[model samples]
Target: MTTHPDELAGRVLSTTQHPWRFALLVMLALELVLLVCLGAARLFLPNVPLIALDLPILLLNAIFAALLLTRLGWWRAAGFRALQRPRDLILLALPVALLIVPALVVGVDVPPFGKALALLVVTLLIAFQEEAIFRGVILHGLAPLGTLHAVLGSALLFGVIHANSLLVGRDPAFVAVQVIGSILGGVGSAALRLRFGSIWPLIALHTLNDFIQFSASQGLAVEQASPVLLIAKLGISSLMALYGFFLLRGTEMRMWPVSAQSAAAP
Candidate 1:
């Protein structure tokens, strides 16, 4: 459903005089909170890629989603709505192609059924949380600044948060590669989220992509970022970002939240 012009969260961000500044703080604050939560999660779960590692984040996402619905009786600009146009279905192509790269380059094996199931669940939640906060909250907060800033800002923050993996004791090289990949994926995902005004399809693509990569390692994906793996991701991710920007370029630029909210008014 579309965001109402009077919705508190959207109105607050879009109508605020310093939306750019507010958006920066909001994104940074989100990253900081999630990072600290990850670090704390490791203290208990310790194992990398734990399903529960993201439970807290999911809780946060649920709470945010609930708050918005309570305020407006429907989700607003949070990528909650389903894909609205049949033509938007084409937007999935680049993301899916980008995700398939590592599998083709390095190959993937199906993990044991239990492990695969677990990864599926974990990655689904992760995709949900990331899209909601990154594409949903951050995009809405920055939408007042115009579509370009919202897309770029969310993508950059998506990359930045991957740095938290280093804090969990990952190799710097590996973390660096992850950061870059996240940014590229983020750019494409953010652009598509705005275009399709939905998150379910992106969520599915993200879960499958990560599940394959994680399964490929049989566990060491956490411990290593092989040179070949890094190189393959960089190449494909660059193409993904390019396609995303091109899609964005084809669309007319506007203050997204403001325009959307205004249109929703009867």
Candidate 2:
């Protein structure tokens, strides 16, 4: 019997889905290239704006997501859902709350709020663009592999991509916590896509979470290195991971099909 592409993907994931394992490596390589290119471009031009790269990157990911959906014949599932349910809102809110806890723990610096508008703009741009790329295009491309594989693949990629940004002057422990939190966020985003088959809620949640964090960290000057802040970050990250775990286990039994099990066998 000839296996369908989707079925084949599902099968590969059934045994031990190494999709994220591989995807992260490729994403890291691309990120390195992008870093070099950006540095070189800035060096030569000296006037190129960093934001110039944001929109184009987002557009490319949106295009890639569309292409993947087309390949799987799920092309129509490309945009936002018309009516986001209460549960979706609730799920999105949990992470936002996670973001706020650190602020409460260490107290945010109020001075940045004066420039909150600019901070909000930057967070919106980066968060939506990055989420669309990792959770949309990259995740959708791995969809043929099954939801579990897609989530893992996309989450790992998201984590690694952010790791590059965290390599600078930040605390290593804090960076590690944020990466774990990002992975947790990735899981929630993937679950939302699997349940709703759209990216709007994820996009919203992504933007809001970042906006809250940016506003808190920069605008409010929440103590970044305080022990209290670190605990809150890790604590919330753990909670998100737990939430993602249960959400996945619950959703998988309902949505995955029998074909997923047999697709991998030759």
Candidate 3:
């Protein structure tokens, strides 16, 4: 029998297990890249624009993701498939909708056209790098643990990793909101990736979400706006998490084909 491409992908990529040692090394490599970027920024580009620093960081992540992909032998699994259902599109848009209220309330200053274009480029890179690592490497590595575990594990890691924002002296309240929001957003993005078998829409939605948030942060805004906005944001995020959970429960009995027997085999 001919296997569907998606099924084949799940069997070939999700079933393959890397050594625990390799997983630890990949996670360590990510941290090292982050430390190097922050160190370089502090030592040399203290006064540079945030994007100037972020661009190099994003580039390093892209390089690391590429290496991880090769090391894991997931070339076929990384294919960007088309969205196959209407629900897939809705899941992709849900995260963007969550940001709409905040964008309206905070409002953004119109930057010069060139600067705005440059900012968009930087945000796109940020989205690419983040999804490639969290949703790509981490998700693939953890798939044998079952979809629920993989989804929640990756999401929690995503949130915890953002704690690094505190090191830059961001307000505690702001960092807390960001970290929580990231965890919630990670659930939705990971579900959409699994459901649609593609990362393109996630990248687009993530870019839009980040660009709006980044613009609002740089523009004029009331100091009190964050807590209120965060409350609303978290509510929406909870709904998203619920939606992803329901979607997973309603789908095929197995999200990936890594059977318990295969998972335990040498």
Candidate 4:
């Protein structure tokens, strides 16, 4: 499931020449287009509500997943192929548990069935679109700049995107806390991709962590006002950020197809 050296060389060359900057500009343009489309849909198509926790989200995820497969191919895009190592799961599970437990402990009020349905829907959406844009396209495109830049760029974008949830009139401090968590989580997830060279496990972990937090909030388990909860959330998130820094600095850095090839020769 490795990327071929020839293909990798071509990608690196194309990116270094003219297309990388062009592609980045194109992506930014498309992002603007998407925003406009969503705005128009909200205004003109008032009746067409996008279900955030239903079949619509699942469908969106499916579409994004398909796009990844098409663009990157089965091997490189599958991400699951790189998730075979045991260390991957261990790294993901710790952060996920830290995020999920305290929130659940506080309690939420949603019914079990409803929670399950919502979790399935939102999890799929988060897994698909978030991972595709952040890990797949952004990180992959920025890989030529070295791993640190890729991690920082992707993590910043991810944090900004997650902050959109604050449009519902959340408190400034609360929003800041959440934004910080997203940055931390994004860095860790980006680091995971660096270590394992895939997106599937990180996608899975992201979906699970978010679902648990959302479910806890809905169920009234998470105490937003509690100092203890805030400390716990921020503490775990900070640890993740530190861990990501070490992971990036360590010698066990994951290699792309070209680097792997170079390392293989005598």
Clash counts for the predictions, in order: 0, 4, 0, 9
What's model 4's overall lDDT? 0.60
Q: Best-fitting candidate, measured by TM-score?
A: 1
lDDT per residue as tens, model 4, 96-203: 766666666766444488668867676767677777767766666666666787688777776776554443334456567778877887787788777776677777
TM-scores, one per candidate: 0.78, 0.66, 0.77, 0.71
Candidate 1: list runs displaced more than 4 Å: 1-16, 31-74, 253-266
Query: Cα deviation of 194 in candidate 2 (Å)?
Result: 2.4
Which number leads on lDDT? 1
Writing each residue's lDDT as its tens digit, candidate 3 over 181-204 gives 889878877887787777778788
lDDT of each: 0.67, 0.58, 0.67, 0.60
The TM-score measured for candidate 2 stands at 0.66
- Candidate RMSDs in order: 4.6, 7.1, 6.5, 5.9
Off by over 4 Å in 2: 1-33, 45-79, 84-87, 109-114, 166-171, 219-224, 252-266
Worst 10 residues of 3 by lDDT: 257-266
Checking candidate 3 for backbone clashes, the offending pairs are: none
Candidate numbers sorted by lDDT from highest down: 1, 3, 4, 2
TM-score pick, better of 1 and 3: 1
Q: Residue 84 in model 2: shift from native, Å? A: 5.6
Candidate 2, lDDT over the whole model:
0.58
For 1-266, candidate 1 gives per-residue lDDT tens digits of 75545564454544346756765665566666667777677787677564345556656755654454344322444666657796878778767766676587667778888877877887777676677667766666666667777788878888987787765556678789889988987877777777776777777877777776667656533667678767776776787788778879865433334443533432
